[model samples]
Target: MKFTTYLRQGAPRLAVVDGGDLIDLNDADAQVPADMRAALRAGADLQAAGRRAIQAGKRQALDGTKLAPLVPEPGKIICLGLNYYDHAKEGGREKPDYPWFFFRAASSLVAHGEAGWLPRVSSRFDYEAELAVVIGTAVPRHTTQADALGHVFGYACFNDMSVRDYQKRTPQWTIGKNFDRTGGFGPVLVTADELAPGATGLRIQSRLNGQVMQDANTDDMIFSVAETIALLAEVLTLEPGDVIVMGTPAGVGQARTPPVWMKAGDTIEIDIERVGLLSNPIANEAA
Candidate 1:
């Protein structure tokens, strides 16, 4: 089942995509949470409720509905860097035995169709297309990589926008990666069962305007979802609504001949096989 979050009466409301329409889960059944986070925490019971709602056949046209970040406020927005070998080689970085993790704040999230700000202080905005995993179950420490993927709920396309200057100012990438509205989170979340295990072997790409800029397959990731989860679980409990942005590929604008950067009025899009498309417009922060 495909799930999405949109605004209803000024607050986030969870919906299940049925063909070209969306069924508002809350309206269909009160047992279904009104938001994605709550539904995730509700676990299997919520899934059953959503299935029942679909059976009831109450749905609204999906076109142009206002959307909210898929998770709105993920407890942790963890990201991987240089998770693709080609991307690592292109960026002049060596492959590490461990995943390079970073965090993006909830404040930086912008949903699909929303405007992502081009910060006034920098013109070096670059796009990194990635596959983001949403955790559904709480994972305990010492979980094996083999068992780690069972904790995932679903997957979504993500564009991890970055401000180059600030990212280079310090060894830590938090400043550069945390610019408000830089994280393009979703259009819809495709349940884990709908895709190949660990979401590997899927094609992922990014488009600038209508032109394709980054293209690669999820199979290229250096750290698989299960491995990354196990690695992360060692450090902290992976809880429901926590997200893991499985790093981008080799075609980012930063590696271009003279470099390419996003500016006002540009549209950036991320398309991951099975996950769905996530697109956003760029606007000047001051505007």
Candidate 2:
């Protein structure tokens, strides 16, 4: 089942998407949490409740609804760098034996239909189309790859926007990546069961102002979802509501001839086959 988190009276509400309508799950069953993170923490029982709501609850028009970031506030937002071969080559880097992990603060996330801030201090912002995984269960430390899939709840499309100037100021990427509202996170969350095992072999792309900037397949990823999780679990527990953004493919604005940074008024889109499309307008960060 597809799930969406949208705003009602400026507060987030969890709903199940059904044929152009949204069924508010919490309204259908008070037992279900109104937040996606909370609901997922509630476990499989909440999934059953969502299914029942799709059949018996009232439906609300999905159009004109204001969306919220899929998780709103993920405890840990881990990202991979140079996980795609061509992407590494574009930046004059080698395919590494281990995943290059980075973290993004919760304040950086911007929901679909909202604007992605282009910091006034820099115009070197770039777009990265990536597949983001939403962890559903708490993974025990040292879990195996075989058991990692059980911890995933769903998948979503993500635009891992970058502030190139700040990113290059230091070797660590956290400062540049944590610019408020730079990460475009969701429109809908497609459960893991809805796609192929590990979400492999799917096409993912990024478009800027209607032109395709990046086009590649998930098959190009150096590390698959299960492998990444297993590796992560070996060090720390993967808790529910945590997000893992698989790295992007080659065609980013930074690697292009003469560069192509996003400016105010440009719109960026991330389309991940079978997951969903996430679109966000570019806007200058308010002074």
Candidate 3:
């Protein structure tokens, strides 16, 4: 089932998407929490409740509501860099034997249709389309790849917008990746059961304004979700609501002949097959 979070009465609320309508899970069943992260922590029982809620016929049209990040305050937002072979090659690097991981602060997140601010300090902002994995169950350290997939709840489209200059300031990418309101995180989260295991072989693409920029298949990733999770779990525990943003593909702006950057009034979109499309508009920081 597809799930999303949206603003209702000025607070974030979880809903189950049914076609173009949204069924407020909390309203339908008081047992279900209003927050997507909390509902996810409740485990599969909440999904069963959500299914019942959808059957109760208490949905509202989705268009009028303001969407929120799928998990508004994910405990951890782990991202992989150079995980795609083609992307590595484009960056003038060889395929990596291990996934390069980084963290994105919660404050950096923005939901679909929201404005992704182009910082006044820099105009070299670029987009990286990625697949975001939302953790469901707590995974213990040393878990095997075979068991890692079970801990995933869902997947969503992610646009890992970067400020290229800040990214190169230091070897670590934290500063460049964590600019406020740069992470495009939602539209909808498709439960793992709804797609192929590990979400492999899906078409992922990025479009700036109306033109396609990055285009590739999830299968091209050198580190699969299960493998990345297992490797990460070996060092740290994976908790529910933690998100893993699998890396982008070959066509990033920095590698282009004439680097393409996102500027005010532009719209950036990341569309992942079977997951959903996440779109954001660009605006000056003051706007």
Write one digit per residue (lDDT tens) for candidate 3, span 73-120.
999999999988999999999988888899999999998999998999
Candidate 2, 1-287: lDDT as tens digits: 78989998999898999879999999999988899888877774556877899889999888778999988989899999999999999999999899999999889999999999989899999999999999998999999999999888889999999999999999988888989999999999998988988899899999999999999999999999999999998899988899999999999999989999999999999999988899999999988
lDDT of each: 0.91, 0.92, 0.91
Candidate 1 lDDT, 1-287, residue by residue in tens = 89898898779888889888889888888876787887777774556776888899588887888999999989999999999999999999989789989999999999999999999999999999999999999999989998998889889999899999999999989899999999999999999989999998899999999999988999999999999999988989988989999999999998999999999999999999878999999999954
lDDT of 1: 0.91
lDDT of 3: 0.91
Clash totals, every prediction: 0, 0, 0
Could you tell me which 10 consecutive residues in candidate 1 have the lowest summed lDDT? 41-50
Where is model 2 more than 4 Å wrong at Cα? Answer: none
lDDT of 2: 0.92
Against the correct fold, how does model 1 do in TM-score?
Answer: 0.98
Candidate 2 lDDT score at position 41: 77
